[model samples]
Target: MVRVTGNEASMVLVMGVTGSGKSRFVNLLRGGSVEEGDGLMSVTQECQIVRVKIGSELAYVVDTPGFDDTTRSDADIFEEITTFLATQYASGLALKGITFLHRITDVRMQGSTLSTMTMFKELCGDHALKSVVLLTTFWDKLSDKSIGARRQQELRQEFWLDMTAKGSQVRRFDGSRDMAEALVMRLVDRPPVVLQIQRDIMQQGKRLEDTGVGRKIATRLDRSLEEKDKELEDLEKQISKASKRRSSRDLKQLEERLGRKLTERERIYASRQKLKASLGPEINAKVEKQQKSSPIMDKIQFFASILGMTVSVTTNIVLPLLGVAF
Candidate 1:
């Protein structure tokens, strides 16, 4: 979840072992095309930083080489992550947090994966408190029970319990279209003020996010305003005619009453318009800003962008290269 705004920027790292579906998850989150690969096999030999937009914010999702690569030693992997973080921070990018992505299909958590997580935590220092553990690739296989329950049980027996006891947030995510909404809700701690307005509208049997009532109200209001204006114009004409005739004072009084009613209606319409103008964007901005600080949101945004870009790059460039060579 990379949200970039003119106000501030945050960077997140998506990390996992080879074949843990890091690239797939990234592409899914990003709404991008999927690439063909079995882990870290790619044209990209080193770590890469991909930029993505989330609402009014800019987010950078850094994808590092897989931690459990057979060719790369544990020390080398650790150094690679450390170097990336150091370079980013030195370049004045704010280091917000890391998402430790694990494949739900992968029943075994290797030692190298654990080591990678530990190294990230140590490198981040106090900021590690902001870290989120995202269990990715969850929808790979369906089961009556939770996938890899035995492995999850083992993790709970070992790491999960400890992390929970220490107040770390852990969430399970299956990369899908609804991922953004899910991530946004999880990350945004404060309710949007516009939600109150929506609630009010809902009580009147309407929903703000729903197109039906809002559109109906808008149409009706426009017609009503036009009709009222016409009525006011007619009343003025009647008043003028009555004054010229010098026969009926009652018609003049009726015209005055209609004039007052029209003024009141216009005032109410103006007030509603003012309320809509004031609350809509203000609430949206608040909701979006709060989302940027969310670990889950950050993870979703980063992975989504990376996955899309990776797939596009692979399809357009890598696949063509292979075709040319073969």
Candidate 2:
């Protein structure tokens, strides 16, 4: 039981879509099988924690369900994550880093992949992004080796530009335990940070629906419903056209599917409403304050550390070489 003893252990959240190698990544770190699945089915259902020792200190890794999950609703996934984070925060656990697993083989970032990244950033907020590591996986699966470098370069420029500019580190995971540990160890040694969602739901006593990320989640749900409505409308028009051709079987099946889809959407919306239940007024003054102040402080601190390292290198190596030459 690698319990956190007064913030000594760093808790890291493993995030990404299905088959992005999140469970495999953490399994390597903890030397345990976390039930990795295949072929469009989600393996991990909810958030599970595996604790391992990094050096002399214990650290914990949380494996979360991915986006586009076949079995679970988006609302369910979001709620599960929010509750787990809030529980950890209440237990005095502080997150030191978050690892976003992405497949190097994914040549393009659009659709669900892009939306997943957006939700992740919204969850982390700008303040906590400094501790994020966008760990790209499946390096060993590159069939054409030359293309891997090109794809990674594209990801850096096109996909990860803004987050990288905000102090997030990017690294390659080569399907090795040592590689995963090396990536995580760099973060576990750093100072702990409370994510914006954690701070809002814990310190300020706000509901999950009231937090900035929570509100973002709600907005996402709204957009999803709107999209689903459009999809249903299109299906209805198609069904109407198919009726003229006596394609009753397929049209009826499609209508049934749309009806079920609409019901699911309504269920998710109702779940949010039930959870909301007037959990007090939305008071996130502290979260707003941090958002305004953190970026400037973080940039200054980042540059200062770099300058210090450059000075150290000059004194330790460059100056000695110059002296010998003189």
Candidate 2 lDDT (Cα, whole model)? 0.68
Model 2: CA > 4 A from native: 1-7, 223-262, 274-326
TM-score top scorer: 2
Regions of candidate 1 where Cα sits further than 4 Å from its true position: 1-7, 31-36, 39-44, 147-150, 180-326
Q: What are the per-residue Cα lDDT tens digits for candidate 2 across 173-282? A: 67876667666666777788887777666667777678765676677777777887888788888888888889889888988988887887787677566446322222
Query: Candidate 1 lDDT, tens digit per residue, 1-326?
Result: 23443445455556666766656655644544334376444322356554555454445556666655666433344434433443343223455544566666665766756765554444433324444544545555647435566666666567666554544455555555355223432332222111112332322332232322233334545666677777777878877787788857767696768879788667646533532322233333444454555434343333333223231222110111111110
Assess the local accuracy of residue 65 in candidate 2 as a C-alpha lDDT between 0 and 100. Answer: 97
Per-prediction count of colliding residue pairs?
A: 17, 0
- Tell me the lDDT of model 2 at 2: 20
